[model samples]
Target: MKPMKLMKEIASDIVSLVYPHICVGCGSVMPFGGGILCAECRADFDEPVLDRCPVCGRIIYHRGKCRSCNGTRLYFDRGHSVFEYKDNVRNAVLNCKYRNMKHIGRYFGEIMADYAEKNALCGFDMVTAVPLHKNRMRQRGYNQSDIPAAMVASRLNTPCVSALERVVDTKPQNFLSREERLKNIKRAFAVRDKEAIKGKSILLIDDIYTTGATVNECAKVLKKNGASRVEFLTFSCRAED
Candidate 1:
């Protein structure tokens, strides 16, 4: 190797030794160029979701709606999640939300984008992220879904429209039971642009899916405002069974 090139490599190694990149999923030091998730975390996360319920997108064993959707009236036509909310995936999402690791959100966005492409989940006129209420946005400094939603839109070469707004500042859905979640999230969102939404297929992106109350409510608002079709994609889904 040339002397200058060797020196540059040495300097990079020294810099990395001083300030190593940490894996967002496991909080371990990442090898140079290993990216956000380390090898083990990647292996745990990238497995294809198998036997998922088509209606609510929860991983399931049999056909048709899973337990979460079997008895309920849903607003969104259908939805799918990239990973079930557990283990490393769960840790990463919590880190993104609580620890304010924006890069982790972006990493999930790229993962979602890749999943969309591989699964042929395109054809939406616009992509959107579930919005944060103004108060939450102020407290959190950013919507965790926004960067990933925009990245997915960029992958599809479509516009990422801010088409919905959260009108109510409800309690976090994680703390509530399914019944309570439904009550807490009811009518929480409103469409921002009926004209843009009318007759358009919308792809909504979020970080996690639990009882389906939140995204279902968003879908209800979209359809109510005349959106032709509403589908949601999330980084993880709760495996209730």
Candidate 2:
């Protein structure tokens, strides 16, 4: 190893010892060389659980599918999420999306990358993000989903394709009821460049999966424009059942 790089690593270790990194969920001083979180918190995080809905991959217990997906049409071939969006997961997403905490995005992206590696997510030919309308993009200054999408695409060794465009200025899905959400995003996305998606399997990346309305609608547009298959990776999902 280069001496300069080795020195930097040693210095970083010394700094961590003096001021231990804090855990995002608990605010406790993370143990030395313990990686992202302390053992206790790591144990508490119930990841890699198999109890998920077959279609959307949200956590399902006893119920066949989450109520949000029941009787609803989905356009994607499959969907997967890293964690259930509750408590710490919810706040972490809000912080990254609305509070400009981009490090949170990178952290969640690492989790998604791990899941992708374990679950053989390298089959997709291209990757894309859920598009934000021009108006909303201007208001937010950045697309929250793009950050994690970039990270995951980089990890998956695929080009992140910006193939979909949000031509319609739809109402915010969070502010609307279930019926209104479907109405708001219907026909909201369009595939601008056909050549990029034609005959390719595309992975759509997003920060959160809620009613499956938004991602499914985007997938429908991509498939209509000749995408062979559409799949998704999301950071979090709510218990809609």
Candidate 3:
């Protein structure tokens, strides 16, 4: 091996010894070259997705179209997701969102970008995140979805645009019934720069996809403001129930 390369590796090893990386999933010290998650945790995050809704990408019972997609109209054309939200996948998401482990977002963002690449889902006019309300943003110190969205744009060679804003501080959607979720998110978001999204095909990024209420509402607002098309991608989603 080149002497300089060997030296650099030694230096990296020394630095790692001094400040080791911690696995976010189990809070264990990470080995050299390990990812944000350890191998076992990665297995958890890699929960297999057998089948999902074409419109919302949630796991479905029988598979033609998910019951949710059939029952309620989705505003976005279609969607893609990376993992089933359960076990360590759920733990990782919660840790990233509430535990200040922002690097987890970057890690998942790379995976999301890879999924887009392998699936031929790139080449969007813009990539954007479902915005947090300014209040929520301040409280949380950041929006968990923002980093992944930005990372995806960087990976896909596109612009990451902040084209929408959460206008209302709505209650958490998981706590609400489907109908209540619809009502809660009504007018919950507003487009920031209509011209930026107008006539553009946009990819909306988020951390999770549950009932589709959040992305559907965001898509509705974007389309209403003149966007040509809108589609969503998420890190994890609810499995078949």
Best by TM-score: 1
Q: Rate the local accuracy (lDDT) of all candidates.
A: 0.86, 0.79, 0.83
The positional error of residue 150 in candidate 3, measured at the CA in angstroms, is 1.2
Using all chains and alpha carbons, the TM-scores for the candidates as numbered come to 0.89, 0.81, 0.87
Best by lDDT: 1
Better model by TM-score, 1 or 3? Answer: 1
Task: List, in order, the clash count of every candidate structure.
Answer: 0, 0, 0
Q: Candidate 1: lDDT of 128?
A: 98
Lowest summed lDDT across 10 adjacent residues in model 2 is found at 15-24
* Tens digits of per-residue lDDT for model 3, 71-170: 8776798888888887777877888887656667778888998988878887689999999998877656578999889988888889999999999999
> Looking at model 1, how many pairs of residues clash?
0
| Error of model 2, residue 172, in angstroms | 2.2
Off by over 4 Å in 3: 1-20
Off by more than 4 A, model 2: 1-50
lDDT of 1 by residue, 1-241 (tens): 8777577567645643433377777888877777777899889997767788878789887777798788888888879899999988998899888775666776898889998898788899999999999998866667999999999999988899999999999998888888999999998999887899999999999999988898999999999899999999999998867
